[model samples]
Target: MDLKKILWDFFFLLFETGSHSAGSLLRQSPQPRHTLHAGPRLSASASSKELLMKLRRNTGYSFVNCKKALETCGGDLKQAEIWLHKQAQKEGWSKAAKLQGRKTKEGLIGLLQEGNTTVLVEVNCETDFVSRNLKFQQLVQQVALGTMMYCQSLKDQLSTYSKGFLNSSELSGLPAGPDRDGSLKDQLALAIGKLGENMTLKRAAWVKVPSGFYVGSYVHGAMQSPSLHNLVLGKYGALVICETSEQKTNLEDIGRRLGQHVVGMAPLSVGSLDDEPGGEAETKMLSQPYLLDPSITLGQYVQPQGVSVVDFVRFECGEGEEAAETE
Candidate 1:
């Protein structure tokens, strides 16, 4: 309390009194009725919700992740999308590493045929629910297609190769992604991130038909995809290579039935029907009875139809120990 302090305090006191009087008069005169006003906070909230929905639909990310991205980017759609992709990829890699050891015992077998070559891929997930997801199915189809292209590039060398087996590591470098701009592994990581589940490209195999032979395939329990018509997805699938004297068009029915027979009968080899009457015949494709008309053996069914089952491969989801035993 100096004299200067006292003077300053008095000056502020006088100013406060004048402002109070003005406010009182202003309040008394503010009586406007039926005035319309837009709430800024409500508008902002609605916009945020719309933005979140758009981000979710465009990115196929979780709502929680979408909202967080929007908030982190301050409601910017493009920036949020970039942030989500980066974050999701990072998270996906982390999740995939952590879940790598988990047994992926459920999934689908995807089959795709291009001309005389056909590829079958098995993609495994943790649960059936995740396996049935459209994204997961799309992943399988993409992997199959990518593997087909990879094999096609080796067409010249494949002439001598009976069949080619592709492990995950081999396919990891193949091109994938929505725009075919990323590696297969990156696409897989993204899927794992979005689905929040352990997924693996367990195994893929491709068979190329030799000259004078035709290939036919069937997929049991298949569900048609909205986008891909050439690809078939199901729990069980098979491809049969037949050397037929009949026209390719005429062999279509027998070829498809042979495929079904291989899948349904689970033959170990295309043993000659005359190998013996015992184990060889029992486990031979030709010796097995036709599924459509069980009264006749497959050899008799196709022999009269001018079809000879040259070779076949079958795939079943989660076959595990039973599959090994059969092999």
Candidate 2:
């Protein structure tokens, strides 16, 4: 039987059987929807959105045309895009003008606390492209979360012996530059350079208390792709950390509750910036609480903008971080 006649017969069956028509067609052979195009496949399956971006960037066409082409070709990107261009001229539809530029800075600021340990870290990249890369973004999150679990109270309050230092592989040898041979900071900087974009530690915080129910944490957007995280992407993400009794709430429950609390009340410092946000950025950011609240004075929270605020590290991205330029 000719392929054309077979298709005609299938369509007739489709009309006769309605929903069952597709099922019958599927039972006979590979479903058309699941079939791949006759060309090289992407490294990973490109999302509909990603494909749309490729079309716009490569062809400088509109989103609508790209979408229509993709659908009309049964997900054949090449054919759909080609059809879009031709249709553009035939229909007098102006080429979808390239969307205006916005430095869609993408990355994430992760916050986590278990027991008395808590930390916040900013992992950023120049363009959304690198930021959205899964490996890059996940590295940032895991590091941030790990730092909170292990480093929070490890090194605070130096005695006559060792300086107030934290534990964890991270502080294994500090005063050792960003890398040791390189620190996480140094490693992050190198990654930014390698990717040809600026990346830096905007800020970080760690907290541990001797007693009391230590606050726990909750992630705002758990289902979001790590690659697509937007740290300075605007008020893009939220982290909720709250102080509660371990006795009253289970550890897992505490994290969820605190996260819920955070969704509502934007607590500053989780307690007090006076001893909260550690690291240089935190010290600088502490001023706002002083500036806004009359209860505290400059003698308390205020610190020289240039001074290091390492003590108050994970307090969310420091209010205003100076940008680094790459040569």
Candidate 3:
């Protein structure tokens, strides 16, 4: 049918339906009450406000982006959320690529212990401010947990006396997220997008406590994680492996104190007083003065209690390769 005829017929049918007579239409004002636009203006309608707020609350996205997603998905909240995640992932990778070469000298050291094995991970970013962010902290914690799981998966290939280290490239491919179904690189990319910083998973270390020994851990400048359990974030962290002749003693407490000493004193190697001579002993874990009791060397303090230090791992944020060699 012709356009004009179709419009006329539509109007005729409307009049015939008797909402308003043709004479009544003529009696209406000459101009329309609402101004007409060439196209629909993007807006949050009253009916969609509830949906918009729900989407914002659930996704933690900005109001403007949530509104756009809702509009793009025709106000279907589920579809809108999925759309937002996809867009964020897409934008995250793009941002990560652009910022890949920027220096990341500030971040957190994450510590996690599972059974006899302990894991420490250093995840770096562009600034200390991002280090304190909850999302960034969560990412670091998840990476540490993933590092533990990754090391555990390789247990059969390693010896009891062995220590495992995973560099940046190897860490990027591991599983991350709460369920650990997502790639670590993708998780990091999402964080880089949201936090607007270049980040890298610099390194991870795994150590297993041998039979009759325990691993003790501590974090300097430590704070309890807001989301994850048994995970701590800090500027410096340490894990100490200890062997004790007295099995009835409080070994955990001793191990923790040793860890604190390691974090605070920054020991270079796990040397005994017999092995390190003169000034060299100052940098050895056992020969140095214990941080909590400076009058006593760590060896002097623990030996009477039948505890002997075996091995340790210490991580400081933004430390160079020279410092990493101590691990």
TM-score of each: 0.77, 0.37, 0.78
Cα deviation in Å at residue 214, candidate 3? 0.5
The sequence of per-residue lDDT tens digits that candidate 2 reaches over residues 90-112 is 43212111211323245665654
Q: Give lDDT tens digits, candidate 3, residues 1-327.
A: 699999999998987777666567778874655335322332435457889889999877899999999989988998998888778888889999999889999999888877777888999999988898988987898898788777777645433445667889888999884564478887888788789999999999888755667778998888887776778888898888777645745777887898998888888888875753324347887888778888778887777777777788888898884335553
Clashes of each: 0, 25, 0
Candidate 1, residues 1-327, lDDT tens digits: the string is 699999999999999999999998778754443233346667878998999999999988889999999989988999999899889789999999988888888999998888867888888899999998998988898898888888777736434225667776777887773455578888799889879899987778887866667887888999875488988899998888777554766676777788898888888888785754333247777777767777777787777777777777788887762222222
Task: Please name the candidate that would achieve the greatest TM-score relative to the true structure.
Answer: 3
Residue pairs with colliding backbones in model 1 are: none
Candidate 3 clashing pairs? none
- Per-model CA lDDT versus the true structure: 0.80, 0.44, 0.80
| Distance from true location, Cα of 141 in model 2, Å | 4.5
Once fitted onto the true fold, the runs of candidate 3 whose alpha carbons sit more than 4 angstroms away are: 1-47, 155-162, 245-249, 321-327
Q: Rank the candidates by TM-score, best first.
A: 3, 1, 2
